[model samples]
Target: MDGIFDMLILGAGPAGISAALTAHARGRSALVLSSDPMNTPLARAPRIDNYPGLPGMSGRELLAAMGESLEEQGISRVTGRATAVAPFGGTFMVSAEQDVYRARTLILAVGAQQGAKPFPGEAELLGRGVSYCATCDGMLYRGKRVAVLGLGAAGEKDAAFLERVGCQVLYLGPTQAKKCEIKGTDRVTGLVADGEEYPVEGVFILRDTVAASVLLPGLAMEGGHITVGADMAASVPGVFAAGDCTGRPYQIARAVGQGNIAALAADAYMRKEQEKQK
Candidate 1:
């Protein structure tokens, strides 16, 4: 698909969907890549009370309504996990498992970064020998021994890709140890799992969600949340954030409001970029 969008939104929850709606309403092309079902956490909740006009409805009901709205509006959504987002030629490039997308602006509305409990030496060896995206960094370890701690289907797919690329892949399944250690002096040398050590050149920790910092290098964060201003613009230029990923007050109404702000900010940023080009 040679699709180039005006705004590329990560996450399909209220924030991401709302951002898409706003962008589209403003006559901008938008695409959303969502791995999780729309607001899975919210859908599991028995009821939500704070979101006005949709009061007392079950979370699942609210999610269904949101889905229908997005469908009615003809918003495009790609059901894949985004591995990385990189700046390219004043725009952005988003990489999923099977495809890459281009956009002039980006919105990081991917809810919260869950299930990223750090392993020993994981932080220190980041980019040295430890990585989050196998698809993005797998080639760096071609023909080298690597350990992949995968959480779900995405992890399995990453491991398979590594194997296909001639890398010796030691895939540790869905069960991740709470305290596995990445052992090495300068770079990643091995991984200690369940009290056993396996010599490896790199460790790829593939989970469903990743820290924003890992997704876009140099994207500023505060205490695990993507730092955003009142307009929902993030520390990185041309990037905006909304929903739980931006931080708490984790309410549906708040998420939707922030999503609107982020979309408007992205629209303004795109206009500025266009003017500069002209």
Candidate 2:
């Protein structure tokens, strides 16, 4: 396959970065794929307060440190969402909207998205009155009172999309009190702050991410998690899973640990393939 990576790690957080660094250190071509607002959970943590060495450091600080390490390692970064991974000939290709990245081995470090705070009607009316992806279901509430339940870029974009569709869009997020940078009127309503609720026919949770499911197929997902084997391989071969996307115990250190192990396994698998060729 053309434009294939020897190893392509999805997500830019701790796990993805760690795996890319390790693969690079081993002299394997590696690329990290991530979307915007890269910090994710680390950016939201009130403070680190834990995780060794940086006892008092904030989560954002730790995240920055890790990001710096990846940069120092000369690891390449691709800003795109992984929509799916499929076996292509003898290698794997991670698909995004713009292009398809090939990798003999893949590391799914795409971390779990941040949890959503459901309002009174948010959960009760799911599908009926709530949604997560505007791209997926924006047309459902055309010309209706639809609220975007997030303040991040994704939320803002969703609001814009809804507004374009002639839906009454309300912007809501963690910092909804702050004046919004996104501009729209008529179909788009202003934001509703954190402590308040808005009367909308539907609330879309667009908190800063492209849903991971959009990228992978046949994923063993249960409640927004992909199952991984002991070696961190998903049910699929030549593919490994790590970090929060693998499920609970969503800690930076744990993600780093999983990334390291997954890299080793991928490396070993590649070596075996080379030997088989001989």
TM-score of each: 0.84, 0.68
Task: Give me candidate 2's TM-score against the actual structure.
Answer: 0.68
lDDT of 2 by residue, 84-201 (tens): 4678888887766447788898898878865422334333344555555677678888988877766456667768888998898766665653422221233323224444545556
lDDT of each: 0.85, 0.71
- Candidate 1 lDDT tens digits, 1-278: 34679999998888988999999899999998887664367778898887889778998888779877888999888787776788998889998865889998999988767665567787778879998777778899999999999865577888999999889999998775555899997999999998999999999987777668878878888888899999999988999999999899788888898889999999999898889989
Model 2 spans > 4 angstroms off? 37-39, 114-152, 158-207, 210-214
TM-score of 1: 0.84
Residue 276: error of model 1 in Å? Answer: 2.6
After superposing candidate 1 on the true structure, give the runs of residues whose Cα lies further than 4 Å from its correct spot.
117-145, 156-175, 184-187, 194-196
Any idea how many clashes model 1 has? 0
